[model samples]
Target: MRKHFFGSAERLHLVLMLALTFSTGVVDAMGYLGLDRVFTGNMTGNVVLLGMAMAGGTSLPILRPALALAFFMLGAALAGRLLRRNGEGWSPQTSAALLAVSLGLWALTVFVLLAPVQADPTLGSTVTSALALLMGTQAATAKRLKVAEITTVVVTSTITGLASDSRLAGGKGTFWQRRALAIALIMLGALAGAAALHVHLALALALAAVIATAVTVTGHVAHRRAEAEAKTGAESPSLARD
Candidate 1:
């Protein structure tokens, strides 16, 4: 059990999960601050916000929220295709590819922000939609991977699990602890990103790109090790005979 818990693969997965959480926080903060309260990283929140907007209680534009939802679904579909093709072997390669695409989009966003020419609302909306789609793709990939206590993009369910499994509720699980840690990390990332955004939005995004790149490298290494081991085992005669 100790070996399983502290294994290199497990550690790599944990690091990648945390990196995804941080990415979500940074992107979500950008969306909220720059895109009129629409959460690009958390589609669940966007769905709720969309419903509220449809009810006419909020000032959010219905079309933008709807576009966000559609784009998110499209991203999820793309991730699903990757998962289906790769199976459990998807590993870091899938994440690396997705992050690479996301990095490109973020670079474009930075260019737009730095450009002397200002964009109209339509252009801004398009940017937000693309960012949201990238985030959604990530969220779906994580979901398909099904890493415990590390969904990374949204924590509402994690928070609920924490509370439901707390000591006061006669539970002995560490759900609350894990959930709290995730929330804390996200808050820290958002705070750091927000501070950076004040002076340099591109800088904050660049930080996210760095984190994603690190995760991608680590994941690929781990997956390669696993594949090597699997191949070695397959070639063992006794194992094959059995």
Candidate 2:
């Protein structure tokens, strides 16, 4: 049981997913509290908000969520294209690239947050929208990659999976622990991010960028090693014959 939980590829996938989940929680919390309650990671909430805004029923405008959804789709589409071009083997590389992009965007957001620009409502809205879109894009890309547990943008599906597969529901325990762990990590990250925000918003963004960069580096390393092994095996006479 211990080996199955810790020595499996699923475990590694869960670790990576946990990292992304933490990042998502941090970013989403920042966006919601600091950016006027707009969710950056969860596009579903953003879509609903967009509709409400379209009907002129809320202070939140529709354009921001609309742009976020568009960017998210674009990011997912990009991931799909990469998958088609490189196959499942490219999942790590593609995910790393998307995370790298997300890190850069988050860094830019931090810079903007520290800038001397006045806090105008319109500008705030636009900037918030852009950041939210970046988050959505990151989330969508993760989803497209089908990484085991790292769908870093939202928890609705995770919650659904947990409840639907609970022992009380007469379901097997497969992946249930992983799902619960992911949710917990995300919540913890959100709390940490909120604390950082209380001290400094720029600091929170910086922290998020750091996490993303770390994931990018690790994913790249793992991908290269896997690719090298694949190449080595392909060239070996034994493997070739098989």
Candidate 3:
């Protein structure tokens, strides 16, 4: 039954996206707690921080958040261009983008471990911006995959859907399983991220990168197998539910 459920392409996308969402939570925690309150994944939180920073009172950073937002948009634009012509669901371009995200995270992990990132404020901000850029790429890729209710970065809408679509709201409470799992995984990721931060920021980042790599490899392999089976005129597992 588990394999039968995962045979559905949409369900596979949902699972992979939820995994990425967990990675987002880990890095977001690292960003907020370790990087001067700048959000690397959650743009909404960054916007709020930017607003407070512009108010000109506290030690809130104006440049970090601003740069993070800009780089994030830039990353999204780049991913959009790369994926503009492709249809929805996991594709070669999607794999490429996800691979880039994983590699970028690994690169950042190495830098934090080897470089004096803590000693230089500019370097820390640079790392945060890079993280935001990678997350933007990830977000755009996940969006292109068209997994409903799983954005892989933020959960505000998911939270709203959880409440608004509940039986109490007269809705059928559809997809409450994935929705609730998305919320829980992100919180658990934040907890793990914070705990890892006590050891080293690099460790948290490495964990995120590992998850990205796992998603990329597994999703790509499954997609390829589905496509091959389709070409052979066999019933593709991905379309079994369809």
How many clashes in each candidate?
0, 0, 0
lDDT of 3 by residue, 1-242 (tens): 12434877788888889999999999999988888888898999889988887888499888888989999998999999999999988899999999999999999999999987777899998999999999999999999998878998888999999999999999999878888999999998899899999999999999999999999998998888877766765556557869
User: For residue 234, what is the lDDT in candidate 1?
Assistant: 68
Best by lDDT: 3
Q: Which regions of candidate 1 fall more than 4 Å away from where they truly are?
A: 1-6, 89-97, 116-119, 233-242
Better of 2 and 3 by TM-score: 3
lDDT of 2 by residue, 1-242 (tens): 11322463445545766787897788777766766666767788888887788788758756656766676666656555655555443366566556656566676556657663225656656555556656655665556556664587777788888888888888885678778888898899889778887876666677777777776666556656666776776689876688
Name every residue pair that clashes in candidate 3.
none
Ordered from best to worst TM-score, the candidate numbers read: 3, 1, 2
- The models' CA-based lDDT, in order, is 0.71, 0.67, 0.90
Query: Which portions of model 2 miss their true places by more than 4 Å?
Result: 1-10, 54-58, 89-96, 116-118, 234-242
lDDT (tens digit, per residue) of candidate 1 on 1-242: 11232375655566677777987788777667755677777878778887887788658667666777888888878878767766553465476656655576557557656753224677667766877677777777777666778787888888777887888778876755567878877888788767776865566667777777776666666677677777787689777698
Error of 1 at 117 (Å): 8.7
Superposition error at 170 for model 3 (Å)? 1.5
Clashing pairs in model 1?
A: none
Lowest-lDDT window of 10 residues in candidate 3?
Answer: 1-10
Provide the lDDT at 213 for model 2.
73
